[model samples]
Target: MRILAVDDDLHMLQFVAGELRQHGYEVISAENGEQALARLEQQTVDLAIVDVMMPGIDGFELTERIHTDYDIPVILLTARHHIEDKERGFLAGSDDYLVKPFESKELLFRVKAILRRYDHPANNTLTAGSLTIDLKSYELRSPNGLSFIPLKEFELLALLASKPRHVFTRDAIIESVWGLDFQGDEQTINVHIKRLRTRLEQFAPDVKIVTVRGVGYKLEADS
Candidate 1:
């Protein structure tokens, strides 16, 4: 998963980014709120960590803007443990709050908790270009007609479509779709990917799953 870390303090920003990166998450750093919003325009991030104090936009306004514009969950960081600040943070749409001088483990724990909540969205259907995936019915609908997809294939497609253009590592995909105890060869993923490619070609021509060489796969759609 990718996280955006925004802080005016360079040292604090670097520390947060380093800690998150050590745990296998992709980190993007921004020195201020404007930079953070610009980064959001350039790429997709699963979550954002914003400092409460900044020069221009500050964390509260930034959090609200992110909540309103991007729909990405945010964690607000404040040096003060004031109840008012915490309340404001939540009112600004922050999913969680972290006080300054916190343990890295605590930060990681909160990040994991918020992300887990976001992982399972209430919406059972997903849209990708001209295709709509009905998770409940296991149906793929396109402009042409509805197509039946195998359980595994449907799951794989849904996973990729969940985060369009975000690179999902092979290990992550295997663990998520096949479970940690899966004993099947990696070729199983390749076969399913090939089949999915053919199905997309026939049903949703505008949507394609591109291989990332040594990485796993990501779904791309024509905008």
Candidate 2:
């Protein structure tokens, strides 16, 4: 999963980013709320951690904008621990609040909890039509039977399946699945698509990952 860590304190931002990365999450860092907004426009992350005390576009305002514009979950990482401050954080649409001097493990747990709740995988499986992708069980099921889904393939397919029939451009796919800093080209996407097709052919024939000619790709059911 990808997380955006926004704070004006460079040291704090770096610490959060490094900590999240150590936990196997892809972390994006922004020095302030303005930078965070710009990063959001260019990258897609599962969650955001914002510090409340910022020079401008304080964490509360940033949280409101994030929830409103991106519909992404946010956790307020502020020093303020007062009851009213937390109320404002929630009212601003923060899914959770963590005061400074927090344990990294606790932050990781909260992030996972929110993502698990929001993404709401089908008991760790995602299904469309007769096809199912079981993340926990590491099995893909269809009318034909079951097959294995590799990590990148699963991430890519799941992303596309998250919004069936909605075309995803290569750039968007790269940013979403691979991180904005991934040093790969369109061939990377093509290779993953090819492999995904090979795996899908083992099970789901009616369900197709269609490339829109010059555009990108989408998942569709032959109806």
Point to the candidate with the largest TM-score: 1
Q: lDDT at 69 for candidate 1?
A: 72
Tens digit of per-residue lDDT, candidate 1, span 1-223: 8899999999999999999999999999999999998887666678999999999999999999998876789999999989999999999999999999999999999999999999877888999999999988999999989999889999999988887777677777887799989999899999999999999999999999999898678898999
Q: Tell me, what's the RMSD of every candidate? A: 6.2, 6.4
Clashing residue pairs found in predicted model 2: none
Scored by Cα lDDT, where does model 2 land? 0.85
lDDT of model 2 at position 78: 82
Clash tally, candidates in order: 0, 0
Task: For model 1, give the 10-residue run with minimal summed lDDT.
Answer: 163-172
Query: Candidate 2, residues 1-223: lDDT per residue as tens digits?
Result: 8899999989889888998898899998998889998887666567899999999889999999988766679999888779999999999999999998898889889988999898774477777667887767767788887777668888898887766666677888998889879997899999999988877766787778999887688887666
List runs of model 1 lying over 4 Å from the truth.
127-132, 136-223
Relative to the unseen true structure, what is the Cα RMSD of model 2?
A: 6.4
